[model samples]
Target: MSKRKKAPSGNPANRGLSFVDRRIARDFERWLAASDTPLSDPHNAAGAVGHLFDITKRSGLDILEPSDTADIADMLLDIGPNATGMVDLFHDYVHFRLETSRDPRWHQAHDELEDVLDDDTGISAMLEAIITDAETRDPAVIADALAHTKVIDGVTKLLDWISTSRPITDTGALRLSDIEPAAAALGLRAAGARTLPATGDLHGQTAIADGITYVQSMWHLEPLAAWWRALLDTDVLELTASRVRPGRASQRWRTEPTPPLDVASEVVALVVSDTVLGDLPRPLRLGCFTLPGARHTCARGPHPRRRRQARTPHRDRRTIRPPCRTRLADARRSRPGRTDPQPPRHPIRRSRGLARRLCYRPARGPR
Candidate 1:
């Protein structure tokens, strides 16, 4: 994970939760910028007074955190006809423009995504499709993918340990001697070979390949223990009480080296993602961005309204270490009443996870 560059602009304590705040704040701005709603118009100014106040109240509500899938769906549905548009802006801002500045590291994983945002004006359709699926998606899908990832992680470690000792018994089954150390690696508990029941409901479900049973490892027992049992139940090891290595997928997984945590997380997310969702490869990736707490100019921390109001191009003010740009826009040409040339009104139609894409302007010479 990227280290917090300069201590997030929010409370140090609040940094943990600031990912949601920062994401919501920027989402709100991007939505307003891309929508048909003309924030720059004088007539809309009459309504802006009430919506801005509502934005303040809503932001104070910790962004109306949804408890379940239904709550999010309701919030988004209401935004469509509520007429004020603040609810919609705040409620669903997944379609957003990417900032001009980005860390080089993220480019490796998201290079194609960045290209899509920068060049694909059609991204708005994709963004809408994502939202449709996201509303129906379990908000905790990321957590679920991580849980699966742990299994992959724990199992890989256990298998490596097994290879060194070859803990196989005379009967050709392996023993669980010294298994606790493997379990400890994953922060999970292991048994003394006789702790768990000899057979689970799928006692005979082992996959026998070339006379060697290859048991399938599905969701069970944290991550490590379930995998340990896969080996034991398949007779790779003597089926003892405590088993289940977290990372290994099945008997075949042993033949191949385990993927890096990032790769593993992405693969697992894809396995769980629906086509409509486009892709689920990056809860861990997004976490990588937010977990470190994105840096912004305001040291007191980022507020959605404050985030929205800061429209000027900050130049070098909040250039995050490793290059995470905090400025939502390069507002030099975006400020009102300036008769300078402007990019398309809604240059890059995007939002929330849709962060990426700004006006593709030519390189400028230093003024």
Candidate 2:
């Protein structure tokens, strides 16, 4: 699939000298002044802000208030209802302004003052949407969520390993197994660890290397771009990208200091979020809720929506949590393992459920 669709915003340089427009232009100038993308580039913030501003002017409103995110429904009605490239330009510009611009005036190429979205929901919703989109599995949405969990495991394991030790390969190239399967490998993390990079190659994920199923598997089973974007958002991870793979120009991620708590999100990719997940398959958003531990005994229960809870309640809090370290020898050595069998690992981040599943191990990251 094409990674993302970006629209062209009209000429920000052509904005009027009216007080509201000038204030917006000034904000765009300051925001663009600090941007990494040069002003000359069409993709840059200042270059495209004016395109949609013109649309707002045509609407007779000081600002452009989009009725829908994926498709600017209101704008399309004003023009024609066709999904033209020009419409795409407007859509892309909205997200571009929202993500790249520093101020709200520049966010939608408009003049009306509106507060930015609730930070927590905006961040978490974007995350869930991406992971759901990234999934390409045949089984169900749960499979995709499971695979994302594995990626988190892989990342956490790699961070713990590389920071405390040196790279296994002399040239600083870490293998795939080193990073994936991080949850299961915790027992072996101190003993034998696999340090794989974020791979763009799907075939390589399951292709055997060094006698393990790519150490931890399933991350590459989804769209490679999503996997790359998912973990890159956290500020804790400082990935030094390497191109050391034999055939592919894949990333060779190495360890940074163990991530400290409290990094929210990043916008490296122009993600196809900010829209309601109505564009995606229903299974991705609506899911089954089974008994926490009893897979064999229990039948698939009604999902969160069926229970009449608020929609997408999980996204309400987008907090970043650091991985907690367990000192088994000092604290739990005297205690014995429980006689009851351990429960299955929860795929997505259900902290309490995952705790029961990954009993006595580190938690999955800021899910």
Q: Give one digit per residue, the lDDT tens place, for model 1 in 1-367.
A: 8876774453232234445554544444554555566553433433442343333333222222221112222222222234336433332232222332243322222332233223325444654454356446553564344445554455456556755344433322234455346555455544333333334422332222332222222211223333342234233333223332323334545554433333333333322221111111122122222110111111112212112222224322111111011122233112111112211121111122222211111111111
Output the TM-score of candidate 2: 0.22
What does candidate 2's lDDT look like per residue over 1-367, in tens digits? 8777776554544545366665665465555555554453535545455645544454343342332221232333223223244444454446556775566544333221121111123234433444455434343444334434434335445444445433323322234444443323332221123444344222333333333333222232222223333333333233344422211111222322322221211111111110111111112211211112222112222222121132233422112111111112223222111111211111232222111121211222332
Question: Runs in model 1 with CA error above 4 Å?
Answer: 1-40, 61-153, 157-185, 188-252, 260-262, 265-367
- lDDT against the true structure, per candidate, is 0.32, 0.31
Model 2 misplaced regions, further than 4 Å: 1-157, 164-174, 183-219, 223-231, 241-261, 264-367
lDDT of 2 at 236: 28
Best by lDDT: 1
For candidate 1, the per-residue lDDT at 116 reads 25
